[model samples]
Target: MPQFSRHSRRGRILIAIGLGALLVGTSACTRIRTHQGYQVDKLLVDSVQPGIDNRASVEGTLGRPSFVSQFGEKDWYYVSRDMRALAFSSPKPVDQTILRVRFDPAGNVVAVDRMGLEKVANISPMGATTPTLGRHRSLFDEIFGNIGAVGAAGMGGGSGGGAGGGPNGS
Candidate 1:
């Protein structure tokens, strides 16, 4: 009986160690979740010199911009985002960057600007219901409002039936 207990105790110890290791591995993986976009390098961004790099050179050096301005063709934007999420929660922004490069009419880089996460704005609606100018109506009101608005087909005037309103003489 003493030998059997020793063997069973050793088995239990091994099982506990395995279970602990598995849990640690899984939790580590959950914390390591990271999402990246653009992945711009600081050296590459600094290499782009305004008034010196044209569109072709800029594209060759830093690849292509993430997006071009909709209103102005000469403006380009390089956007980067890094997000981290643990388990099932929504990913939170760890880092974000928006590099705006403006070009002159001649296609030469005229200005370079950078914006960080500090510039981000979150907008929330003020109330549970949006206020409007028109009167509020329920489903019953909308369905029954037009019930008495229509008349019988012949009760109203027919085409060209008014006094002295025909093509020929009355």
Candidate 2:
């Protein structure tokens, strides 16, 4: 009986400790929950001295850029991010640091200028995925949806035909 009581007491202690840890973890994760978004950063290199700051030297000084210029190697992008909440959702960029190092024909760091989040405008937030307006159900949409939709009957699908104006003041 003594040994049984000791075992039971230990089990209860372990369960209590586990529950305490779970509560602490769940509560701690909800604090602040800050988030940073992915963007090209507001950094634009007005000038760069190629020989002074080459690709290799730049890489060694600053970390790798998030993206590179598509047209040429003259441009570099340093992207940063954080999470919003613990759930899976895109975060708003609270901050951005874009260091544009323009190279003078030769590809040297001519000038080094940094752009922080302050330079970025609210109108043009970071991120390539712009929040575009959703498509409204229009005449063309109905036609496209109903083009092959006629045969879609019994396929558990259907569409309503309501008069809707078209674009171009028609």
Candidate 3:
């Protein structure tokens, strides 16, 4: 009976340790959900009507917009994003909404447009360094290349102070 009890206790301890490890592992891998920018309320968004809703009414309904157009036609943008990320990873957009309200010169709503994740652009950098129009220079060239070029040629007429004449004017 004593031997059996001892074996059972050891088995229980092992099972408890295994379960703890599993719980910790799963918690580490669990995704973190985040919301950014404007929070959308379906009822409130639906209430905004073109022509009937002016700038003041739209602002009261949706609060402040995320951004307003700087040039060309006047437009208000309300952007929202739902993101998810695992441990130490960059957050990726799971869903996105961009609501645009176009206005006429009188500041009355002309059109209301809603866009989803289909309009989202995923841009990746082409390379480590941006391409430029010039000769490729080495680290040493960039650092020390301009050492003697400062006073050379058209650069202030060498060191004569004026033209090719010296201090005494040749």
Model 1 — which ten-residue stretch has the worst lDDT?
Answer: 152-161
- Preferred candidate (lDDT higher): 1 or 2: 1
Taking the tens digit of each residue's C-alpha lDDT, what string does model 2 give over 12-129? Answer: 9999999999999887666345544334322323223455667666666665676777878777766554434443444556556666655455656666656777766556568876
- Write down the TM-score of every candidate: 0.70, 0.41, 0.81
Candidate 3 lDDT tens digits, 1-170:
99999999999999999999999999999999999999999999999999799999999999999999989648999999999999879999999999999999999999999999998789999979888998999999999988978878876635665644876764
Best by lDDT: 3
lDDT of 3 at 88: 76
* C-alpha local distance difference test of each model: 0.84, 0.61, 0.92
Q: After superposition, how far is residue 158 of candidate 3 from its true place, in Å?
A: 6.4
Q: What is the lDDT of residue 146 in candidate 2?
A: 60
- lDDT (0-100) at residue 67 of candidate 2? 74
> How would you encode candidate 1's per-residue C-alpha lDDT over 54-141 as one tens digit per residue?
9999889878889999987789888888877876777777888999889998999999899989976766789798888988999999
Sort all candidates by TM-score, best to worst: 3, 1, 2
After superposition on all CA atoms, how large is the RMSD of candidate 2? Answer: 13.1
Alpha-carbon deviation at 114 in model 3, angstroms: 0.8
1 versus 2: better TM-score goes to: 1
